[model samples]
Target: MLQVEHLHKSFADFKAVAGADLTVRQGDLVAVIGPNGAGKTTLFNLITGHLTPDRGRILFKDVDVTGLPAHEICRKGIARSFQIANIFPRLSVFRNVQVSVLSQKKLSHTLFRPAQTLVVEETNRILDSVGLSDKKLDIAGSLSHGDKRVLEIAIALGNEPELLILDEPTAGMSPDETTTTMDLVKRLATEQGLTILFCEHDMDVVFNVATSIMVMQHGQTIIQGRPQEVRQNVTVQEAYLGGA
Candidate 1:
């Protein structure tokens, strides 16, 4: 569903992503794993239009979308969740999701209508999918960290994206919460048929859930293969395991 060809991005003298090429097929759960400064997030920024690539092409479906604006890319059916919780702190969970739903529909100007009443059913469905239905009326800032992350996922879901780009979805959660988040992501791909491309530091999470894994080091992909194949790769072992 997504194709990145010979992608390169640089900041000043430093190259962050160097000729990175990747393809994510429909309904595939692909994980990009790398250490700090490996350029995983930079690749994501390039694809999502947060940063223009110094070189290369980004194709979604079959159309080239190299330098499209973030919102335009999102409208083209790609949605991203940040490593941090990017929630509207003061907005109720329902309203937060409602805003996304409105944004997706280009109805942001419908301010006079009650957002809750306008998108209540769809918002509730998203909340249930993310296991946050009971917290629909709660303030976003007041939820626990794990719930906040789930809220971020819910917000991403609001766009009904064909491809979801998640940066560190299980970043700071406890063991149980991480497991729950992993389960949610698996269901997103398996049941909902959403294509997932994520960057994660948690090896166990990557190994357990990823259909394929790409290992990056020094701003380049060192290995791309199935979980077991990547696990046994010599360079991966030398760079990630030996270092760990």
Candidate 2:
């Protein structure tokens, strides 16, 4: 569903992404895993238009999306959640997602329409999908850190994206919370048929939920393969897995 080829991006003298290539097929739960400074986030930024690449290509469903503006790319069916929870903390959980649904439907400025009545079902459905329906009326700022992250995912789903990019979807979660979040991710792919690409530092989470894994280091892809293969790779062991 998405293809990134030999992507290179640099900041003056720092090469954040140098020759990174990745391919994510439809219904894929692809995980990008690497140690710190591996440029996983930079590559994601390039693909999602947060950062323009110095050179290379990003193709989504066969169309070149490289260098498109972030909003334009989002309109083209790619939605992302950041490493940090990005949501309207002051808004109710429902309102937070409602805004995204409204934006997606181009109804954010319907002055004559009562915004409360707009996309009610859509917002509720997204909340339900992310297991946040019970918290729909709560203030977003009051949610637990893990639920806040799930709220971010729900907000991304408001875009109805064909490709969902999650940056460290389980970061900062407790053990049980990590399990729950990753389980939600698995269901999104297996049951809902969503194509997902995520970057994570949790080895257990990556190995347990990823259909495939790509390891990166020093701004480049070291290898991409099934989890078992990656776990056993000599270089991966030496570089990041600590020979485990």
Candidate 3:
């Protein structure tokens, strides 16, 4: 559960997030949708503490986390994936998730500890969850773009986050790959009850997978409603859906 009130962020003369307000309740798979330069990614950055807001407040699980560092946000049960893949290229797929697991346990300094095989089972389980069990031995850089995205999600899930924020989870995938990845996301939200807040440009993905939708424009929230409500909203249609 998260609540953001009148969040404002700016860079010199340009405002990236201007008085944006959002509330993500438990069990809500919320879609953040807007055109390019609508501050969607900037909003996520603000929420995750990658960029501190100039004003307003961010409350995660009823605790004010405004301006907390990125690591602190992750430790507090919020994990995120980026628009671009972020993974260890040379590490094996299994090792990628293992690194996150070790980091979660504060044991990243113990890398290459053959005597301490502590995260093997957890890493295997995480790889299996992401459908990468077969490729666990392969180098992460060798994976397809879609598998890489799945791996990123696995890494984010390594710490068992309560709220997962995905920024453009299907940015560069083939149609089939996009379906597979988004289906995986949907299953996590529906079957595993993982709360998700995703920013997506794909209208089909947004309408099909999200329970609720938030439309942003000019660095502000313009619409927040159920899927159907967002679909038919006149303002959203004029400002966002129409262009998309």
- Alpha-carbon RMSD to native, per candidate: 1.9, 1.5, 2.0
| lDDT by residue (tens digit), candidate 1, 95-207 | 88878987887665546566546677788889899899898999999999998998999999999899999999989999999999999999999889999999999888999
TM-score of each: 0.95, 0.96, 0.95
Best by TM-score: 2
Q: What tens-digit string does per-residue lDDT give for candidate 2 at 126-191? A: 999889999999999999999999999999999989999999998999999999999999998887
lDDT of 3 at 194: 89
Candidate 1 clashes between residue pairs 3 or more apart in a chain or in different chains: none
For 182-233, candidate 3 gives per-residue lDDT tens digits of 9999988887778999999999999999988998999999878899988888
Cα lDDT, model 2, residue 62: 97
lDDT of each: 0.89, 0.93, 0.90
Superior candidate under TM-score, 1 versus 2: 2
Worst 10 residues of 3 by lDDT: 107-116
